[model samples]
Target chain A: MAPMRIDQLTPGTVAHIVAIDLDELGERRLREHGLDEGVEVELLHRAAFGADPLAVRVGNACVAMRRSQAAGVTVRVAQRLEAAE
Target chain B: MSEVMTAPVVALVGNPNAGKTSLFNALTGARQKVANYPGVTVERKAGTLTLPDGSRAELIDLPGAHSLEPRSPDEEVTRDVLVGAYAHERVPDAIIAVVDATNLASQLRFVLELKALGRPMVVALNMMDLAERDGFFIDYEALARELALPVIPTVAVRRRGLEAVIAAARDALNAAEISAIRSADAPAMLVEAIGDMRGHQRQARDIAAKVVSGGDANQMTRQIDRLVLHPVSGPVLLAVILFLMFQAVFAWATPFADAIEGAIGWAQGIVMTSLPAGPVRGFLTEGLLGGVGAVIVFLPQIVILFAFILVLEQSGYMTRAAFLMDRLMAGVGLSGRAFIPLLSSFACAIPGIMATRSIADPKDRLTTILIAPLMTCSARLPVYAVIIAAFIPDRTVGGLANMQGLVLFGLYAFGVVGALAAAWVLRLTVTKGAGGGFLMEMPKYQLPAIRDLAIGIWQRAWAFLRRAGTIILVSTMVLWVFASYPKAPDGVSQVDYSIAGRIGAGLEVVFAPIGFNKEISIALVPGMAAREVAVAALGTVYAIDADDEELLEVELADRLRGAWPLPTALAFLAWFVFAPQCISTFAVTRRETNGWRWPIFMFSYLFVMAYLGAGATYWISKWALGG
Candidate 1:
């Protein structure tokens, strides 16, 4: 599939960050968390009741962010290498 | 240490939850002071550590951030200190860049940025033990060589590698002069020179590849997350955790509270015999012990509550809870970030309001602050316990839940709903529209460190005790004076003739609609300082009104059972739920916001809400089951 906003990915899919389109504050904050372009990320889970804030793994840290926040970052969906296994 | 032999300053900086705070605690031990960073609201911690060479060095715990690029006020403090832009703080002579061994690729880039400031630096590979246990080995020496800084492996939880860290810090400080490290002219534009963050990111990855021998994703963490973050089970688990936390707070703290209360009573007996029957002895018993000791009894509950908070925070589950709660809170026009500060309000609104500093948007932060007091704080526990004990019968429902306990839970639920409703209203009226985006880092899961948890619990306990000693003491003495003066016109009760009594009588006209009698109105005056004082005040009123000396020893709850009508009891509980009785909350609101505007507004709004809420409860109860 083509690259899409990080919030678009469902649980268990892995992706690499492509770019962040955000206001200055949001951009600065996300960039500080090592979410710059080319960094690998994986969608971990969504919240239980209303799955708005998605917990995505960035590097070794697990970050929880709302889709409104995650909408800024575009992620290139990782190819399913696990399918080979 | 002499002023001439001034200790050098070394900063410990890292991404949040990299164990930087634990490393600081291990290194500095108990010799640390927490203060606001000059003008900013960011907490600045500095501690003294004795170096191996028998000289002391100052350790500064800089706010955690991934890069020098400032995002929030906290990060701005770190950036300013590092770049020598903050006027009040001198640039640290050396920086200890604390990095997690498991998260080298991301953490090392931060170290790279810190190095650009051109100060003597070392990498403290914190949580090395956790790394090795999870099956990885790092060539720390190679990491050091690649970055041109020393690398020390530290297990901060176990106090391992602390000596090596201190020695490394001492060496760095000795090698670099403080004056040389800091120059107003030195223009720390060196970050751009070393290359932008992207360049450093690639270099950090290459360095990580060389130094990291073998590792896998944390398997246990992944499994825990699978269970903890599941859509169905996660929210249920969170509710259970919070529910049990509240249940445990009440269940576990009773014995300790009773023991402490007995000790105070015993001490009062001992001191009573030595003093003459005069004002000095009376002051010691009533103003100091009675007033302050009322709060001290609740310390056990506060400690129990904080222990759970500290453990959850340290174990990295709090962020997951934030993610879960954000869904509901978002509908009320608050970001998930406000969940923490608001939750903390259950223990006390002061810290809850203070905790709002981490919320990035000012509008969201202010709105959260305005509604924090609506959440029932621990101070309200004594009032509720007394009322519930008096009015509600001790019957178990479903053979498991006690009726009184269920009512207490209902009050907590009411507080939550009230806070949500207040936030919604405040967002519509007092704040800008609340669509602030929240992006919080969920730290990797680890067992909460025993030492860190102990420190956290101790810090909170000390803070509570300190408040009891100062604020609670002063307010008690002032109210005692108000309750004691004018010699109580001949043959009249002391409180009846005093200023407090007169004011209470005057206020009774206003409170009558809400089912408060003259005694309850009188109690509300001191209750402004602390909520529990109202119970004691009522006890005094009844004791004097009955003219029975033995009445002083009787439980106020028993007295209330016969005195107050059922509707009055309901009204009182409703009043407490909405009333801004504690002056301390408003005082703190003033300090945190740096003005009187929010506190005054908070007080006025809460008073109106309390009166209305109580009036409705009283009338409704009377109508439903005639007064």
Candidate 2:
């Protein structure tokens, strides 16, 4: 299976970022927040309305970013952690 | 170091949630000075810190920046000041890079970047308590040895290791080789990594791996996020918190507001009875007391509102609220960051406009400032109250809600709708630019410290009071002169004979089509000073005795009902919903935007809205009511 964009990962799935493709500013913002190649990311929650912005845990900080921005980040799935736990 | 006589300067730099502010407060207590940087609106916060040796040093808290590379205006200020490129602030003798221990891997990236600057610096590992609570022990000594710097573990809120941190910073500043150290060239790799975010991040993680021992995940934050970020419960809880905040602003603040109002009234009474009737009495009672007192009465509401805002921000729930509201705000081309500022505008637009500094995107901040006055601030309450009391019947409609209450709610709803519409139009028009992204960190929730919260509230309250004393005070005195002199020839009614009266008569021609009479036109003049003063202005225009405020309200409502038609009263309410009536708001808009162009545009647009809205209300109501 191909590596998926971060926004498509399941809520509890762990992934390693493979590539980030955004405009200069957007890419810089993501990198400054410690989201880069080989960094671990976990999809945690989606906002209620449309779920366009996903709350993902990167390193020890939880970041809120829109799906459009999240779509630029390609990640290889690591494992699916149980959401209930 | 350059100035041998002056106090040594120490700058505290960190990421946004690294407890830098809390540490600053702990270090400096109440001795702090806040001012804007020379050419920008970013705040320059400096305080006097007494070091362990009892000598003082100037501690400045630079704005939080993710890296040395600038992304926003705030980050630009940080980078400029740190590199000694900003003309106003000198380069600091020593730097304290505050890093959150719980999130060391990411935060240390900033520290490493600061280290690359080759400045005399120490690492203050903050939030150590939170790290330990999450089952992690950071070897600070090993980390210090690895990085070749002093690392002090600290819990800022608890004031742990603060002295040690200060002592280390003092030692760094006092070292004779500090200047020599800075002059030495940085390593090639470190210089190359300054602009490379990934390189610094990777280097930070390698250091973190060496010193961090264990990590049982922070289950507390995860469990709370599960509920707080829930699709259904999240917004529901947000709604509940908002409801409580508004309730507190209105309900809990009434008694204090009344006390303040009563005190001012008593002072006016004392001036009236003790002195013979003359210009002195009028100046004291009417100009000073009536004008400034009205604006000051809203201070309690402002304080209460700010208390809730500070608590929400410090507790880390503001970002969560912003996350929930981001979509709704985006519908009008704004990010969730606009939510807090817009919410603050409900209390007053001055602080609301000031709060926009946190919104990194310039276009988004300007748009938010432009629509802030449309939030139906507490200042509009007095005008709305008087108008609703006079026009809307005091009875329940549909057996569930009061008729008067419904009309007030409708007016509030109308203002909100208007603001949203204005924002939508603005984004497409002048403010159109690169759409800003919503990239914010959701920090782990922490209990807000009482001392820090109190200090924040006090600073805001002081700013509000200072504005009241300066701009509001001057405008009221000027209005008093315009309304008082050229006293009426006996029986002519003083307000009609005054200069303000003639100006009102002149303005009546333009306002006539909107169903406003001469008194309404006259009141609109002083109403520009503040929205609530319109009520008092109307009292003056009608020649009513303003002895007792309670009786004045009753007498004013009764008089208004007798003088104006139903359509006229309703039209007046509609006019206030969009009018840019407060001078202080306009002044603040100019200051925040750093120019007159945006404030001018804001005034012109709002005036157009008020005119069209009032005219429409009058014509439709006249046709329906057969007036």
Candidate 3:
């Protein structure tokens, strides 16, 4: 499957992180939070009204990140149970 | 062995919301005082822990960082202290790397990076209870074996498995070669070693996968997230929470405020009855009892205000709040992390500015600090109250909300709008830099720990009293001297010939454009001390009777109504919305920014804004009313 930016995922979409193209510092911070390749990320939802920053679940932690930041992260879509496998 | 060190130092490092601070409080108990890292505003928190064998270890809680690489001044301080490069802080004899057990894969990377430094260290797998509740069956022993270091499982909030961690720390401190990691050469070498974090991440994942963990996703957290992160309901919920918090600060705290007011009044009555009528009496009854006591009266409101912030923060709601505010703030080029600091500024700008130290990006922190004083703090309540009381009628609208209340609400809204506009301008002009997109770790939702909340409130309340006693008291006395001196030139109401009156008369020329007369010009000098002081200042200048402190607000409002024109009164209200901030706010800005540049800039900008805003309001109101 073609990898898409994580920000493209809608609520209920679970994707496996393929790559992160952010700055070194930001990429390192994401890696420290278990957003490395093959880690499963579930797009939670966007914030109310503005809907700019998106929330996602990664490794039992809920992360709130800007859409611009999420765009730097590439992911392959998968079912939640499939990603668990 | 390099040497046996006295008073062994241990650095506790971790990622944000990793339970590092919770473990520190549990380990240190009550013996902790936060001071500044020399020449900077970032806090240096150290506490003493007595080992079972009577040996003492000083534990320093380092600010959370992503890795050994430093990004901003705040993170640089942490990295420098770790590498012994910080000139003021000693490199620790041992390092305690606290990691959250629930998400081992994410936290283990920082552990691996810190391990490369070759420090005598132990890993505290904190929040073990939460991990277990989430069905994360972590083989901490296997993880320990993989790192070849002691891994102690701990529940920081509950203090579970605390003894094992303490035992490990003591052993690491007492072991040989404490100086190995303390050497200057190790940091540069280690930085190079950890440069390839992709390799480290791979290794960390391998170990985490092998720790024989049967992972069970938390159903409770997932369910809660569904509600809190709902597109429609999320922001609505946030607004409701914030509204309740502000409303409670006023409603829930009134009884306590009244009690405090009654107590101070009683004490003042006793003193006034006994003392002879002279300058000593005036100083005691008015300056100390009335002026300083006025600031202290807001303690109940302050306490209630911070209680909400502390609970929201510790309960994991603040991160959610940040997420909610991100898009709104991102329009102005600010990250989500600036949310809490700006929120706290509504109570007082001092802590709000200090809270920015946790933001690792210096530009974001600076931007947040610059806009903090515009949040309309509790100290501005009195000025607003006196104005609204004097001008706005006390009728009910829709039989629920008072006319006066709706006006007050409009004023609050105006202050907030002004703050947002100011922040946007500041970010675009000065202090503009590469904007970092918001990314924050969302900690699991949990009930706030009572002990931690109690300690937090106690510390803030104490600081409030201390500041009231020193700075507020001194400024009050200075105001009194300015009002009472020069003997009234033997006939002119003890003020017309005084230094303060003369200065106010001369300053009226500059202030006249904003519709301020001599009395208001006089009040402005003392209002620089604090926003609330302007009320009492104007009250005294107008020669209101001083028999009862309780009647002061009422008397002042009537005196103001009979004296000033309605347009001039409206102008004064506009002035306070963007008033040139209290001296203490500027003082805090100086400390937080570590320079005079930002403080001077802040004062000048706010002064100009207040002057223009007041003038516009006065002329507009006059036109509308056909005055």
Clashes of each: 0, 0, 0
lDDT of 2 by residue, B1-627 (tens): 345778878999999888999999999999999887665556789999898888899999998878887766677778777776788987787899999898888888888888878778989999998999988889999999988999999999999999899899988987724455443244443455467677778888999889998975567888998989899999999987876676566557778978997898789778867898678876776677766776677778778878998898899898899999998889999998888888778767876787787687899989999999998787777677667768788887888656766676678779889999999999999999866879888888999999899999899888878866876677667767777768777777666778887898899999999999877898898788878777766754553223334332344567788889999998999999999998878888887888899999999999999999999999999999886
Candidate 3 lDDT over B487-591, as tens digits, reads 754445666677788899999999998899988998899888878778767756664233344443445578789889999999999999888759988888887
C-alpha-based local distance difference test score of model 3: 0.81
Alpha-carbon deviation at B266 in model 1, angstroms: 3.0
TM-score of each: 0.93, 0.90, 0.92
Q: How do all the candidates rank in terms of lDDT, highest first?
A: 2, 1, 3
Score candidate 2 by DockQ: 0.75
Colliding residue pairs in candidate 1: none
lDDT tens string, model 1, B1-627?
235766678999998888999999999877788776554456788999898878788899998876677655567778888877888887788899999899888778888888877788878999998799778889998888999998999999889999899889888887786446554534646556234776877788889889897777677888898988888888899989988887787778889988987887777676677787566776676667666776788889889988998888888898878888888888888988898888888888877887887777778888888899888888888788779889999888899767877888888888788888888888888886757777887776878888888888888889888877876677777777777676676778787788878998899999998898877898898788878677656654554444323433555678888889999999999999989998878877887778999999999999998999999999999999955
Model 1 regions more than 4 Å off: A82-85, B1-3, B37-41, B185-187, B190-195, B270-281, B489-491, B535-548
Model 1's lDDT to the true fold? 0.81
Report residue B79 deviation for candidate 3 (angstroms). Answer: 0.9
Off by over 4 Å in 2: A79-85, B1-4, B176-193, B378-412, B526-570, B582-595, B619-626
RMSD of 2: 3.5
lDDT of 1 at B64: 80
- What alpha-carbon RMSD in Å does predicted model 1 have with respect to the real structure? 2.8
Q: Higher TM-score: candidate 1 or 2?
A: 1
